[model samples]
Target: MSHEFTVETGLVAFSVGGRAQFGWLDLVTGSFHSEADGQCINDAIVAVEFSSDVVH
Candidate 1:
């Protein structure tokens, strides 16, 4: 299904997937779909990881 998190500052949302990739995101500027393959998608990142990194 879906999950939602509430922190002191703001809220966070997550969409779990059977596969490594999953997302159903909508933005005010535009909307798009995203995915992850459980692999290194970029080299610019270091010592930091995100469960879902969505780009719209």
Candidate 2:
């Protein structure tokens, strides 16, 4: 299993708070930093391109 990012795989985050956020995701190496303080995310998680959920 490959949890790393490829050429087409990248990360996109939403600003759920009032402040602006930033992240750097390297597609070739599958690396990322999601905060101004330089906090790294879990490297063991799988990167999924598509996700779906339905509610009835």
Candidate 3:
């Protein structure tokens, strides 16, 4: 029960565990930005990676 989306350009937005998150991949700068709680950036990325529509 996973959800996937294709983003060609601009910003990609989503939510996880009632928390709002935003991500953007900058090809020019070779940098990525994700906004979420805590200082652990990996947590945000992981949350987006393993996200699903079905409740577990």
User: By TM-score, who's the top model here?
Assistant: 2
Candidate 1: segments with Cα more than 4 A from true spot: 1-21, 37-56
- Report model 3's TM-score to 2 decimal places: 0.25
> How does each model score on lDDT?
0.28, 0.45, 0.40
Hey, what RMSD does candidate 2 come out at? 10.4
Candidate 3 C-alpha lDDT tens digits along 1-56: 39544323333334444444555544455444563421223333322333436643
Show the colliding residue pairs in model 3: none
TM-score of each: 0.18, 0.29, 0.25
Pairing residues by index, what is the TM-score of model 1? 0.18
Residue 29 Cα positional deviation in candidate 2, in Å, after optimal superposition: 2.3
Clashes of 2: 0
TM-score of 2: 0.29
Clash pairs (backbone) in predicted model 2: none
Pitting candidate 1 against candidate 2, the one with the higher lDDT is 2
